[model samples]
Target chain A: MKKILILVVVALLSATGYGYYLFQKPSKDIATTKPYLSTIAPQLIAKFGSGQTSSSSELLSKVIQVSGKVTDIEKGKESIIIVLNEGIKCEIILDKNPPFVKGDYLTVKGIFSGFDDMFNEISLTKCYIVL
Target chain B: MKNKLLIMLITITVFGAFAQNKKVTRTGSVQFLSKTPIENIAAQNNQVASILLVNEKQIAFNVLMKSFKFEKALMEEHFNEKYVHSNKFPAAKFKGSIPPSVALDKAHNYEGVEINGQMLFHGVKKPLIIIANIEVKEDLSISFSSSFNLKLEDYDIKVPSLVKDKISEQIKISVATNYK
Candidate 1:
């Protein structure tokens, strides 16, 4: 009876530990830098969808840094768009500063927040030019 | 005098034809880097071949990132979530030009030319130069291929150390586009 009870307790502890591991957030070390020239020269980067889906909210509030050439920089009434590569473009809704120019080589560091699906944009809490 | 006028008109038409030939389609591709190769990366705006367009000296291309596809659901998720973050950054574009000496009529041979343009990714823009091979076919289709190295961190693409080598620092891009 004692052996069976100990086995049960061990199993409970292991399951709890595994559950915590699954729910843990991703490490920051995973973020890496890619050169702007390398991004466009041989590869094509573009947006994924129409942004109509209400997903990606769970990843909001996470800090990120991306480097690339500014293709189209639009300073809207309340937001900004800094396109990365032909395949990947990020819409940063600025709470502080204005948008970048079309030719500016910029490095943006900010949190990934929610965006409008139709327009394809995200609300940026903090953004600073790196390059 | 009438013959001279006709000759002058023919000369003008010939010159115009040469100028028209100078302007043609530029083609290329976008490669996604992961330990495993992902297939079927699609762009919604297929009507426009490349990311941007270039005429004489001006350039512009439009690409819908949301349309790009990957075979694996997890990789696609990581691409939009971890690498590209498609929700925040919706599209990628380029506005630049190729060298003047490169002829668009060249057939079946790799014409190495310098491509200079602005590459926008993950909400950042930077000037870029790439070596590309331009191939002109009998059908008047233009195809291009080039390869370059990229670091994920420059654009804030986070990949955990555990799977670091699984992804390559430099991604190779192969592209082919036909005029519509």
Candidate 2:
């Protein structure tokens, strides 16, 4: 009877711990997660090139790390966006500003949401600068 | 001969500058508020891609469903996994043209503008017209803001019967962006 009671208490504690973890806030540091890393030039060429259909099965809804030159930096009221190679756009919403500037060579890590057909570019969200 | 070459170069440079006046922004924000007797839910997506064609007075915006962030993790997950089904229809887009009264080349600070466009969301396309306030700064950057009401039923977003009262049928949406 005592062994059974101890087992029940242990199960209860683990369940509570898992419930807390499931409801925890989304992580902001996606770079350290070792996402699918690639260069900005190839990513853009594959997506926006005239002959390409942007049908890459490898990139959809995956965490990606892209490195390129920072072409634009937009500091909006809600977030800071960094455009790499003039096309690969990433926005950091929740995290504080990283130490970077326009023209700096950097790598951004975020989830590759998808290609914006209208704008003809790859979009990444919840992004943070890795280097 | 030198004079002719210089004149030719000047004309080409001037034309090239005018043709490249388009401005774009990716940090645009779209926020929606749902108010019901039981709860008030709001989500904001800051990773909107948009462009303004200065020559044509046309504006286009594209945003991903997964980019919308909610106050609670559970709410965000339910929104993406259950209602919107981000895996199937990943993006929402708007393409519209502004009125002629809002001069693209004018250096005015702010002007009231009308935009008529088709909004594509959840694999459904609907015609939408919006009244917006536009700001054209001296630096050639453009900013605009607009608010509209969206019906969840129109997009086939189903709210479960169990918590029907917790969600609003008509959601209020507000969008603001700055293009540079």
lDDT for each candidate structure: 0.50, 0.79
Interface RMSD of each: 13.6, 2.7
Q: Which stretches of candidate 1 lie over 4 Å from their true place?
A: A1-131, B1-29, B35-61, B105-108
- For residues B75-179, write the lDDT of model 1, one tens digit per residue: 545766777777678666656686776655555655566778787778888887767676667864455555554556666667788766567555544344443
Residue B127, candidate 2: C-alpha displacement in angstroms: 0.7
Q: How does residue A73 of candidate 2 score in lDDT?
A: 81
* lDDT of each residue in A41-68, candidate 2, tens digit only: 5665565432224464356556787788
Q: Distance (Å) between predicted and true CA of B163, model 1? A: 3.4
Q: TM for chain B in all models?
A: 0.66, 0.90
Could you give the CAPRI-style class of model 2? acceptable
Model 1 docking category: incorrect
TM-scores for every predicted model: 0.46, 0.80
lDDT of 1 at A123: 29
Q: List the residue pairs that clash in candidate 2.
A: none
